[model samples]
Target: MANSPQSKKRARQLVRRTTVNKARRSRIRTYLRKVEEAIASGDKNAASAALQAAQPELMRGVTKGVMHKNTAARKMSRLSARVKAIA
Candidate 1:
């Protein structure tokens, strides 16, 4: 329970931020899923394109603090290598 006026306002702000962060995370997941789908479909061109689009989105997630930079980097590296392996 928020006792003071400032605490109440902070609580409200937290709720709003939580919603925004949730949406951001969902969006990032959607982008990643698209890449995964493309890869699974075994279309090298489409997979590459999806990976291109997803890379920036993943980096943006890192910049916005939704994900860690190294995590994003590792994801990118693995995805790129997989993409490379696709004929």
Candidate 2:
């Protein structure tokens, strides 16, 4: 029940932000999933390329406030390590 005009405006803004954030989160997940699938397929080269592509998108999520920085860092680190270990 946003009675005040400001509150109503804030609610509207929140809805907009939520939609944008959801899209960004979905995009990030898609990139991560690509890496995961490549890893699962045991294609080291493909996994490395997917991870390379995903790293920036994940970091962008952090920068855009869709995800935590350390969370992104941890994901990138683990994915990179896994990519490296895939021989």
After superposing candidate 1, which stretches have Cα over 4 Å from the reference? Answer: none
Candidate 1 lDDT, tens digit per residue, 1-87?
Answer: 999999999999999988988998999899889888888888999999999999999999999888999999999998888888888
Native-structure RMSD, model 1: 1.0
How far off is residue 14 in model 1, in Å? Answer: 0.8
lDDT of each: 0.91, 0.95
Model 2 misses residue 17 by how many Å? 0.3
True-vs-predicted CA distance for residue 6, candidate 1, Å: 2.0
Distance from true position, residue 51, model 2, in Å?
0.7
Clashes (candidate 1): 0
Best by TM-score: 2
Weakest ten-residue segment in model 2 by summed lDDT: 78-87
RMSD of each: 1.0, 0.6
Write down the TM-score of every candidate: 0.92, 0.97
| lDDT, residue 15, candidate 1 | 98
